[model samples]
Target: MTLTQDAAAAEAAAHPRRESVYRPGHPVDIRRTVGMLRRGPGDPTMVFDGAVIWRTVRTSRGAATLALRAVGDEIRASAWGAGADEALETVPALCGAHDDPSGFDPSHHPLIAEVARRSPGIRLARTNEVFDALACAILEQKVTGLEAFRAWRLLVTKFGHRAPGPTPRPMYAAPTASEWHRIPSWDWHRAGVQPPQSKTIVRTAARADSLARAFRAATTGDDRDRVLTSLPGIGVWTSAETRLRALGDPDAVSVGDYHLAHEVGHALTGHRTDDDGMLELLAPWAGHRQRVIRLIFASGVSEPRRGPRLTPADHRRH
Candidate 1:
């Protein structure tokens, strides 16, 4: 059998015959989208075996597992569970089928152009899971990646359900919105989640339905931004992070991120810069700010590390 045919058979057996294939017009690296789905190394919802990436997610129907792999120029997706159809349907957008870089002239900026030239396969990924992405962003508020990921692992492991279908390892699906709101304060504390962050998630989940509706109705970038930021505790940074991952929005720039400005500054100019400075530098690339930033990161340009690293606070101790 051809690789494509083999993959189709593997998928059919796994998901009651629900399978799909997608080929990008340009080169697309599967791992580039990994960061969008993965929370941390210990994330129980996602697993990356040597060959394929297996992920479990909760849909309106039920829990489902999706196995995704890149075969030559095509991406093969298979899934199982009551939500298998919904899960498989999302494969294309998740694999960059919706990415449009039209009118984005890389030649205008030498640094960005060079990065794009070197790695022509980079494509932004979108999840379209609003509540899950919002909840994850909330946990990441005012914390180091390690701290947030640790908290996320604890939260999901304790409250989430076992993954569906055959997987490389035991996996879990993130709890539903109600489950998040129902978690006791002690459990949140035990998970090292601060009160503010935990409360924000609970409140966000409380209006999850309305938020989903608003997102569905929103047609413009401004509409989406307003809907996301209207909720308490969500700001420019958090909203941008959510939009970039959930919607694959090219214009969402994480302006307040800790290191983004400095990295962009050093890559575009010769020195580090503040948020205002970075915004000034990126003004020309208004609609593609995040794309430009990703390119800068892909270029491996970073500001020199000086001063002590951020200490991971033990909220449980407090």
Candidate 2:
């Protein structure tokens, strides 16, 4: 490479582009909002340090490292890499600027009312990167979170591009859709991902571009779910998860989650309930079901454990 090109690259690396958004009256907790996107505590794509949050994202232009910190009334954001500009442009939405709670009446339930009162800064975060959200959502399908997080860590650390800026630790953005589709079967197996989950990712990766466009253009949560579930292996739960993270759809409910129904029911009714019952309980909130769910989770309410936690099945042993 030419010396001029090398010097320019070095200069860019030394100084990241910066932008800040003022939230005069909006009280948004940047961490609580964006924390949902994190798969697990050891997630390679995101990290938290006190009031600051750092993450790596794959944008249409390229990969970027984004750092966000919330001061009194504004959120300070900075980005580095080829996609820095695009990443900076999404700062508002990523910090929950577009997540309106106008129609949500948390008073419908006393518990929800109390929780919402205590946590007024909570807002749904939107990444606006559908493929990344979809890929991770597919990994989490029908598996224990430990298993899903392990597979995600293994695959991303191995295949993703190295983040360009100075980060709290070594971080990497998710692999591009084409790269995800090319992951060999053996690699997936070694990562402890069963064939079914891996195959779904492959199929989804093949149509990532068109899928992103369709999801963005979808006018309603149901419409987005239809487009996502129409694809082979994508289902209602996965579609809901994708919408929650990518589109910040507050109405999205992960109906088929293993523990969610029970947790919500236990928290609200003091007894376990099935998915149908959970839906019925949350129905009163209608357009703000997901917001209500978030409040419940944040409230740290859960059903009493009757037995030891279920162990994750290790497919690699087979």
Candidate 3:
């Protein structure tokens, strides 16, 4: 079978019992959209492994709940509440239909072809929920993911509203911009956030709505980067990292990452390289540098570890 055929078959086989009540103007294949993000294993978030399928969609009145799962031959989608139709329509867009490869011809570029081969399921998971992404990013600043996840879980459970849906599991809505501003320093500390990260989150929350709109307007890497960096505490690395998922930017290389330099170096060359070396190696694919990086990562080439994993610190205990 051709690669495209294989992808379609895999998607169909992945979700068999398709069920959705979303009456949006157009027919949206949730199974196909979810399939694009279903990497086999080893993904940090395990977004494809059936975890993290519960997401909430917020509206002016409140929020709706949606659950996604891969059932045989079709994706099972369930929604609840008056906003179900709106959530259904908006969910696909949030999941990155806008930047999906269905609109792009991968045959035009060698790098894109390589990426498509290595990571057939990689899609831009555009969470149009700007405040949620911003809040999560803030929790991740200079901290281990475990630490961030812990803080996120605590904050959501304590301050966030319960998601409206029929799902068995309780999914907490990420705090809105107004709620984020109301969270006191003590509450953040109790949630294991450091002063610096908390400050950044508070400052950014003030303009979370506006920044999200700016990102939606941005079409190029430079445009997105410029708008993101305009916000306090957002830098090149943060902007690039966010744009990778938010805008599905093909060339948004993360220049200030803590481990990407080493990972890129190891994948491209025999030894570790600095940020400059990584950039030099990737210069050939300037327009598609991010795509190249995703391919190298999806190629499943792990760098040999010389030390233990970074331990997450509990600032509250400290």
Q: Give me the candidate number with maximum TM-score.
A: 2
Against the true structure, candidate 2 reaches a TM-score of 0.94
CA RMSD of each candidate after superposition: 5.2, 2.8, 9.8
lDDT of 3: 0.65
TM-score each candidate: 0.91, 0.94, 0.76
Q: Report the candidate with higher lDDT, 1 versus 2.
A: 2
Instruction: Show model 1 residue runs off by greater than 4 Å.
Output: 1-17
State which candidate, 1 or 3, has the greater lDDT: 1
Q: In each prediction, how many residue pairs overlap at the backbone (N, C-alpha, C within less than 3 A)? A: 0, 0, 9
Better of 1 and 3 by TM-score: 1
Cα lDDT tens digits, model 1, 1-318, are 999668646655755736888777678877766445799888888888877888886888877888999899988888887788888878878877788888777876899999999887777888887888889988998899999999899889889876667777778889999999999999999988899999999998999988977875787667887998887888878888888888888878887888888888898998999999998988888788878887887888888898999889898988
Q: In model 1, what are the clashing residue pairs, if there are any? A: none
Question: Model 1 Cα displacement at 188 (Å)?
Answer: 0.9
Which ranges in model 2 have alpha carbons more than 4 Å from their true place?
1-17, 22-24
Worst 10 residues of 3 by lDDT: 38-47
